[model samples]
Target: MGEFSKTVGEQGENLVSKFLDTIGWVGAQSGESIDCCKSEAHKNPGTNGRKTHGIDFFYSTKSQLQDYTLDNVVMSVKYTDKPYPSNPSTLFKAHLKDLAYTIECYMKSDFRTDNNDEHSMSGIKQANDTGVLFWFTNDKDSDQDVVGKVSTIQLEKSLSFSSIYLVDNSRAAFIYNVIKYVRDNFSEYSFYYHYTFSSANYKGADNERYGIVFPVEYLVSNILPFRLINKDTKKNVFCLASREQFSEESINRLLYLASDISQDFTDEFIFLFPEYDPLHDNKVLMKAKRLVNAKNRAPNIKVLAYNNDFRGLVNE
Candidate 1:
């Protein structure tokens, strides 16, 4: 655990592969030479290119438009800044030994599929395996020792992860400051935002697709974006998307300012429009669908349509 903590845990696994490429995960490298050794005998994808094995990210999330499949989301990334081993089963035995050989080679691969059009990969691998443990850290000041003995249901019923996204380190800078607040307010077209590993029971704002809330006036403005990113002092914020709302009462005043800070058990809400925020002539996605059909609707206060600057939809 040296070498600058393994390069800050490999840059916190490249910010967990850019937060799983903003959410729609799509082949985010590191199968470690195609599921690296277990005594040779690996390599899929036409004998070489397929890669993807136990963890360190190996994705796929598009069941339609251009179709996709492979996504058991096995993960493992730990970047420390010292102070954590105060005996919590010694950091859960090094996180179940880095997720027992990539979940024992993804439970002896096979993921069966005779092309029966696999049911939209239901809930991204129900229990077959869906691990995640980003857990980064700028260390706000101790106390984060592997999330103070956290336990995703005893580490997913004793490993083989079916769901575990402890992305710490102030939630990796509040999802990298909401993709740098849409790459600094749109900075000129080219957009694509996603950060959902599943969860959208909508209608009550309960779409845990990468859950979020962060109130406190998004850190006194300026760049809070909606606050809730304080890894001891990592600090997070939001609330600024006024470069030109267009009209129609400024898209109902940005959907009455996001339903005046919604919260139906908080699950999703990261509003920030600028890169040419056009709400007027009714088109900014029809003013975000009239602010999700205004009048106390708060349909998870989301306003997205196209033009995302995440560059042609996350490839890095």
Candidate 2:
């Protein structure tokens, strides 16, 4: 890579690492090389047998949503100064292949063994190694949905990685916007991940209700539920983030979810969507609120739109 390319790549890695910290994957191992377990299988075309594979970041965490499961995540970050190519399939496939190989070797490497030993818990029954590729671009068309474009690319059966998530600039922007909106608007409240049936079932007394760390599943989810608490008033507010644009159907479903999980002590409920407009969407929001109210007594529901300002990521 050229000097400019290298600089851009490093900046992307830093940005992604900081973002991961907010979602509870903190203190990851960054910029490390692990021994390649399958030298011949993963050999470069014209070079000697592969000796090492470079990893951008690696983190292991106990699943907050799944009972007794551990997640070992390997990440690859690709950032560019230009928009995504007119067609991003070939390049996306190559990136996935490389990440798959990394995971295959990482699963058998000593690094994983050491990490597993250190992070082991008594009730853990399963451990999954997954890869996440964050392909981002800073340009006029940074909103391009690379993940959607590459969704149909067929992968080689030889790739051993089970699950590889693609986070294009578009998806990254959605997540960043949701977090920034919460921080900026609800400054008095602290954020927490809402516990679902899977997580609540196996939670122990010492296991904190305030979830600072999230499971790998949240990275690809369309909706994120948050439980916010005010320090002084000791009041709880339930918030749901919907990545999809605002609509009556979406708001209705979110209402049902909030109603199902909400506690009696919840002070209020808020819904966030990317394309919500107060003037235009208020009618639909009121309709959805009434629909839910007919079945269950709904709380005061506030709707807001989050800004999709991904360009700010580069500045950070």
Candidate 3:
């Protein structure tokens, strides 16, 4: 496949899109169904082939009222290897106009899609509260120094959001790429979900998506399994249950989650934490863990104190 001749920044946007989906963020396109971990190469379609101006990657709650999950994170992905000039003024102006348009749409309730799926003017309202996330490669150092100044410009102009962040890469972001990379390299690591096409119910339905989890049998047949890879070894031997709360029956559901996988996982290790009470329910968890492993389906179990925004903690 020939790669698109996109700018370094455009390439960065594509990378961020993939990262977003892996971390549970769905892409927001004008007239298409939102998908996770899907990448769209940039192509100039405007006057003189200028890159289109709008939300690079917009995410929200997966629930029915899928609105803006977070304010626009005008991504500034820098390529340490490229000789591109750092133009803060140009960057700020572009993002500000983008935010302005976004706010304008929200005010008119026009952000809602024709399918009424995502960014339905539910999560974001104003630009003052939206922050920008900057990503840099190893060589593009200096925090770009102008970031602080640009952020002030954003605050002064919008009076809405003034948050700024910089990261070479987050663990969650790392895991996001690793899963796909590994899935591509090995068929053993490959997994897929089977869902009948759906677009009607918005209760738990994602807009214009194929899978809606309708049939009871779909529980065991279609949903994708989380392949929690150990960062050190780059292996999915360890798994963590991220749910916050769990009742007695919930325990059975959790057990079946790991066991129901089509692939054999007798050697997998699963960890979880009770919702409100973080470190408190080992006895109960152990009982459930034992029941799951009783059939020689043996998978290690433990209670975890999951901290940070990173997905399934690496058991280092």
Candidate 4:
């Protein structure tokens, strides 16, 4: 991790600790929560060999506060400070898979089982409640990239829990905001918005440009309270995007909008399509005799092509 990333991680842990304290948890740690199973393992050595699980924090409720049983509640926390990947769809899929895994594990574990029923091998069917993904950040720079972007969406149709969470976070708030936004703003006219940008590339000129600025403008102009949510702390403003959008004219509209949003934002903007043959000409694909030539000069605009694998290029 970079210096900023390390600082963010530490800050995230501290914020989570504070959140737990607020909810009446006595002790909380940055890592997994394994308090419930620790003693059980000590009594049964064979249990030690099984997988270990943890909740982010463990605490006892005040006896007089309510009739709810303390053993019935388990809290799991996840921390993230990095801007979610630029690709929302892929990130949404991955997050959904993670939630499914967590649910599966919780269902199979002894963490929620009664001591007497432990031998029965039955699973608890009670609803497992999870705290919102907390976001923590000390960066107050208004020139931040995503200060006020918001998207309204609805879950009129049933979606996997993870997908639901993904939509919520994608809007830079906890799942609640996503649910609310959808409930209030969703209509037959509202279209789901998607943004795509290219990775930062060196400007042939000395402007030092990179990122997809085009769609970013659309995000800032349309979305309200443009900010990213940290499940650990809460939603806060954070810059997210690259600077490569200025390289092409066809997409320059997006770049202009992004530039209008924040002057301090600095990142390369990626184009959805890096290369394409508008004429279906095979000559464009042929090996060039020279990398650069006046006669066969490459087109200035980069379009988003269907086959352009953004992740693959980034990995390379």
Each model's lDDT: 0.44, 0.81, 0.40, 0.33
Ranking by lDDT: 2, 1, 3, 4
State the lDDT of candidate 4 residue by residue for 1-316, as single tens digits: 6887667666666765664443234454345433322233323345544344444443322111112112223333334554543433443433333343443444446553433254233222223233233333343322222222222422223222321121122223222232233223323222222222223212112221221111112212222212222345442222222222212343344434434443343222222322334445224323221232334533232223323334434312
Q: lDDT tens digits, residues 1-316, model 1? A: 4687778877777766766655435456564423433433333334543345445664433222111223344567766666555554556556654565466656555532311235444433222344566655555674453443564324334344344445455434444555565655444433332122222223223233222322111211222233233335442322334333234555466555545443322324444433333333336555566556665454543443223455423311
lDDT of 1: 0.44
Query: Over all chains combined, what TM-score does candidate 4 have?
Result: 0.31
Sort by TM-score, top down from the best: 2, 3, 4, 1
For model 1, state the Cα shift of residue 296 in Å: 6.9
lDDT of 3 by residue, 152-200 (tens): 4433453233433433333223334334433443344323222222242
Model 2 misplaced stretches (Cα beyond 4 Å): 199-209, 263-267, 308-316
Q: lDDT value for candidate 3?
A: 0.40
Give the winner by lDDT: 2
The TM-score values for the models, in the order shown, are 0.26, 0.91, 0.35, 0.31
- Candidate 1 displacement at residue 133 in angstroms: 13
What residue pairs are clashing in model 2?
Answer: none
Superposed Cα deviation of residue 24, candidate 4 (Å): 3.5
* Cα error of candidate 3 at position 32, Å: 12
